[model samples]
Target: MNAFSLRRVGLALLAPAIAVVVSVIVTTIVIAAVGSSPGDFWSAMFSNPLPRIRVNVVNQTAMIYTSAVAAAIGFRMGLFNIGLEGQYLMASFAAASFAGAAYVGGFLNVGLSLLIAIAVGAAWAGIAGILRTTRGVSEVISTIMLNAIALTLVGYLVDRYGVHEGNTVRTTKIAAGDMVKGFTPYQARDGQVWALAIIAVLVGVGFWVLLNKTRFGFDLRASGQSESAALASGVNPKRMILVSMMLSGGVAGLIWMPALFGSAGSYGTSFQFGLGFLGIAVALLGRNSPIGMLFGAVLFAYLSAQSNTLTFSTDISPSIVQITQGVAVLAVVISYEVVRRWRARLEQRVVSRELAGAMGATA
Candidate 1:
């Protein structure tokens, strides 16, 4: 990379670095306040690379990375798509219901279910887009409202259609052979690294290519950076908003697949929640880079996995991980503004010097 590229990369990483340092300091204070030896907590956090733990991290990374991308797409387009939680929930429900209802073999079941999820997610997101474009409704408001609606709607749908087995209501049971299977060399007592991990890798690669290498991506980004400038450059701002929002929701749809296909095999009240909101933090931590997003996801997942061991083995509260996550996200947001202003100031100085030099030469 050139000097400029290197500097940009440095700036990109700076926010996450600040988050890590600040979180550690805060966590140390918390541990000390709790009368626990910080070293013991820290030791357990890094020492375990057990096969099962690794598998859990991989699965968590897959879901979080996909969610990060879903949020990042909207962020790149300057759209706050807070509706990812709703979109993914509806998508997962549809995917589960479809897969359970139909047994079209292996890959066909997976493929059709995926398409259904993408479509449902995109459609749900498009409602906010439509409102934004036609009625001037703020996406933040619309998405939040939609999330509430989705939760309520899902509860009704579940009660009306879901199969009740004892206390838990889940979708129809998928065939054991039909569901995607994960493998492990270490032979975990239960659960393997999700085979759907490949899908997360694919999403990251495709995300890079679409945003960096395609004209549509360019238009969407330009629109985000400045709508007036994008219009002048012949990119329609409204179209970009609608399309980007839907695209974001489409990717968000994939967040549940790793767990659904590789583990849960059905959607129910027990399904994961809050991943959508978490995606926003992960996206900010990622700085819109696929590798950065993956790193952030893995870091968060590792922290969770490590925290699990702490509850069973020590007096330390597992809730410390939650505090670390909150602090890291807050620190990242603060550092991002600092970096932005720093870059702007540097640009202004360079411009002023260039103008002064030109005037001197003319004189």
Candidate 2:
């Protein structure tokens, strides 16, 4: 890259780097206040002795990356898809019910279930989009309300039709043969990484291409940056909004698949929650690029795997990572906005200088 390109890249990286440093400082402070040795904490956090933890980190990264990509889709179109939590929960439940029904066998089961998930997620998110495009409803409000409705709807479905083995009610269990097969990463002992992780990588690549390498991407981005300009350019902003939401929801549908195929086996009351919200933070921190999102996912995943070990190996609290994450999100948000404003000012100065010189020469 040229000098200007390198400068822009550095500027893009500065905010996330600052956020990470601040989060680290804040996390160390919390650890110190909790009477833990910072040295021991750092040592325990980075020393990945068990191959299993490393595999878990990779698996977790795959899941988190999926969530980030889903969130990023709506973000690119200036839509805040807060309904991701509801969309994924509803999708996973539907997929579990379908796959567990054993209407088909082997690869067909996985394929059909995947389609069901993507469709359900898109349809669920489409509700908000339709409301927005036709009724002038704000997506933020509709999505939040939809989340509540999804929770209630899923609860009712589970209570009425869910298979009960004991006190718990869940969808029927997927057969062992129908489950997605895992492979041994680096041929590690006792490490079987989920095959769905490959799908996650594909999602990221597709997202990148969709945003950067297509006419639809250009129009979507134009619509995102300025609806009026996009309209003047003959791009339908409403259609873009609806499509973006559905697309985001479709990807959100896959967020739970890794966990489902990896270990969860069935959708239950204890299925993972807060992933949608987590995606928002990841998207914000890694706002600029898909690769940045990967780094963010890996960072959080490493903390997750390593910190859990710390709780058992030492007196340090694993929840410290949560504190750090919370702080990091806030820092990232502030830092990025600041950087944006700074860039705008610098651009303004350049434009102003050029205009002044042009006026002088004309005179």
TM-score of each: 0.91, 0.91
Estimate every model's Cα lDDT from 0 to 1. 0.88, 0.87
Tens-place lDDT digits, model 1, residues 229-250:
9999888899999999999999
User: Where is model 2 poorest over a 10-residue stretch in terms of lDDT?
Assistant: 1-10
Error of 2 at 326 (Å): 1.9
Instruction: Indicate the worst ten consecutive residues by lDDT in candidate 1.
Output: 1-10
Question: What lDDT score goes with residue 96 in model 2?
Answer: 95
Cα lDDT, model 1, residue 78: 92
In candidate 1, which residue ranges exceed 4 Å CA deviation?
1-14, 343-363
Q: How far out, in Å, is residue 245 in model 2?
A: 0.8
